[model samples]
Target: MMNKTNKILIQWLSWPIHVRIALIVILLILFFGELISVIEPKEFPTAFDGIWWAIVTVSTVGFGDSTPKTHAGKLVGMVTILIGASFAASYFAILSAATFQKQQAYVDGEIPFKRKNHVVIIGWNEKAHEMIQSLRAVKPFKQIVLIDHSLKEAPLMENVHFIRGNPTNDFTLLKANVKEADAAIITADQHKNELDADMQSVLVLLALKGINPSLYCVIEILTEHQANNAKRAGADEIIKTYQLTSHFIMSSYLAKNGLSTIYSKLNPATGNSFQVLPVPENLVGKTFKEASIHLLDQESILLGIKREEEAKMNPPLSYEILAGDYLIVFSH
Candidate 1:
């Protein structure tokens, strides 16, 4: 049934200009024709007869079977024919103008700011694309907004929206509804120089924080030096792309075949990825060993505790779980 409706719609849309105009004219004629029929039912006996007379009068066909006898019926027929002729002539012109408006809407970009509890990602690059793809995997149910001036249209993704404008601009940011987003990821500009791009990201961070002071924002910087500045600018978390990998690579090179590959597999995008779970209220005071055993029993491996302001990896078995602590677990 849906396919048949779709086919009919497609056929109607694909009809030539003259055909569409004529169809609309016929519909308008029928409407006024029915109204006239109701106003003077005795003159035009049936509704179909009124419609037939209206069509013939409009088209100059002059079929004698249903001619109007009274002055009122003649007036109705004359007005219907005039309206039908004027509408048919102007119909195609209005259609082309509306088509142009729709095309321009695409070029200008559209962002539905009503979207709430979604992730806003600023900037587009290899890393940003990877982040979006990874987000689709890990956070499939969540909406993602892409803000960039370069993109002409939205990326072909089900849960993603594209806002074509500068990320730092308040108009663009507001269009993405950044203030209401669950979280935001600000990435550096690859098109510009390294330091300049980092500065732009810092400026954007300040703008976002200015709008919503409590918003959780994760920022990407080129160098380790900018991490502190980004934090000062109101970044909740900062990822130093170059510096982070160097330390891991050095550790792997210095030590024997160690945990680098394990870390590589820890991407949240994959099915078997590291996840953070809250300390259960019932087991808030449980020992690390007890928590580990409980989680292991549930087929998840307990890795460590992310306590307030600290990360305790492989804590002593007797270490008690704190109330505000987060359990880092690896799930398959």
Candidate 2:
């Protein structure tokens, strides 16, 4: 009979997590209430008063409104104080740990099977961080999943999900929900040599496309030659980082050392932000000068139009706007 009861107790303990917690909590309250009621029957004239005192003690409220008066009752209260403190603290600690465990699971990339239409950024670096910051400024609510191996803890930031693993692994991409991602960005490793980093980006791009052929993917190529490789790996856009920066930096000398001003003016974070909005349908067939004139009323200065494959900057006044073209405007 003892062995059968022992087996039953083990089975009860092995129940599901919520059930176990419920059972433990219920036991904590009931056993303490029954102990106090039996110790001093007058203090707790009824079971309800016993339960009430137990709840007040265990919750750390200690209202002292219905506390015991007799010596045995006081001893029971002292026992409640000792055990209740630990139970009360452990109760909250368990709750906090459970919440933290869920967050840690997300960091380990264990429970992102439902993440869809979110941005997947592979390879965290300076540029990748800047991209994330820019994204936050532009779209405060956009979901961005950061995949990296070096981070020990998930970034404690809102709208940012963390996945810790090798960026080139298809399994890691799967954990990031690449198959349903809205877009994917691959940044080269700033710590490695340019050639090695660019090749790594290419490899990551290949894995991304392999998992989701239709997912829009943009990759950074540190070396000019690796741009071709990245493109061949099915990258929708290959950003030649060194090449673009070098040209842009050199071009600024033409403005008499106005590089800082030029960069600030072009960057959205510095107040002189550039934005691309859909051109009004009524202005589709209108000339650039006419569109600019009308756009002045909206407090936006038309800089150019983004047509198929490229942007036309400072085009002739007679240039006709095409349908489906985006207007590049400057907003202060």
Give the clashing pairs for model 2: none
- Residues 263-298, model 1: lDDT tens digits: 757677767777777888977999999999998988
Q: Candidate 1, residue 159: CA error in Å? A: 2.5
Q: What is the lDDT of candidate 1?
A: 0.82
Candidate with top lDDT is 2
Q: For candidate 2, write residues 246-290 as lDDT tens digits.
A: 888778766667675656456555556778888789998999999
Q: Model 2 segments beyond 4 Å from truth?
A: 1-22, 31-41, 56-118, 152-159, 177-182, 212-214, 271-279, 324-326
